[model samples]
Target: MSNKCKTAISVIGIVLSIALLAISAVLAEEAIIRPALAVTFTVISAILVFVAIFYAAKIDYETGVYECRKCGHTFKPTFKAYTLGAHTLSTRHLKCSGCGEKSWCKRKNRRV
Candidate 1:
């Protein structure tokens, strides 16, 4: 499997383990668990959700290969993780890879 798949599986396992621990703790001792612990868990869960979003938004660096539209030079366009979204890279300005030219390579990236 790829490194990405391995990392994803590890993250899923951690989340599942945390869930199981929470369930076991609640079932074992009703008095030991406090409201603060509940709030902490909530905060941790929210943070994890945001982290997941960031990870998903991160560019697949190994997969962003695109050709120059003008010169037809096949090259890998730099994969940038834009806060705006995937379409943010559709801007007019583009750097070419073949001749080191600063021209508009309007080609869209195909997922490989």
Candidate 2:
């Protein structure tokens, strides 16, 4: 998966876990100490930490078929990203690598 997707998922997981923990704690009455409650809290906290580590970082670039303004020849550019250990994501960018020209579809397929 892309770094953007990982980051998005991690943020969501953290938010939901915290919210659930807060709600459960507030619902407690008379400060009852229960073994199950402690277990539940531990589980949630662990999940939150795991997600935070997984997301880590993200990088991306794009490439695409383009008409070289100077040479009038079709060219291509490729996008790439690095994140999550050795994982990577890449796709064609809408720009020419040969002559640095812009393609028509430069706006499409933006990485999440």
Candidate 3:
């Protein structure tokens, strides 16, 4: 699966879990069997949300790609490559595959 799809699924899981939790709260106010069912559903949804978030983070860490600002080169540098210089969320110092210059590079969105 692609990073974009994984991210989308993770977002959906978060939203769904929030909605389910809200509904569970409402159900808990009433006295009936529905309250028990609501709690079960809420627990399941919360677990799903957690799993989705973990999967998305793993994908991001593994497939992070960057683009050079000085040159139009796109490359995936290793973790050591990033630590070799300096990096930030917005910019990074890495050798450009196209220009071979160690310069500040811009972070590119891995998702489509």
**Clashes in candidate 3: how many?**
0
Candidate closer to the true structure by lDDT (higher is better), 2 or 3: 3
Worst 10 residues of 2 by lDDT: 79-88
> What's the true lDDT of residue 90 in model 3?
64
Clashing pairs in 3: none
CA lDDT of each prediction against the hidden true structure: 0.53, 0.46, 0.72
* Cand. 3 Cα-lDDT: 0.72
Better of 1 and 2 by TM-score: 1
lDDT of 1: 0.53
Q: After superposition, how far is residue 92 of candidate 3 from its true place, in Å?
A: 11
Query: Which residue runs does candidate 3 get wrong by more than 4 Å?
Result: 65-112
For model 2, the superposed segments whose C-alpha errors exceed 4 Å read 30-112
Candidate that beats the other on lDDT, 1 or 3, i.e. the better one: 3
**Superior by TM-score: candidate 2 or candidate 3:** 3
lDDT of 3 by residue, 1-112 (tens): 7777766877787787778777776776674447668778778778877776666655655657778878778887776685565766667788888888877887776654
C-alpha lDDT of residue 65 in model 3: 75
How well is each residue in 14-74 modelled by candidate 1, as lDDT tens digits?
A: 5765675566457446655576775666566656655654554443334344455567776
Find the candidate with the highest lDDT and give its number: 3
Error of 2 at 97 (Å): 29
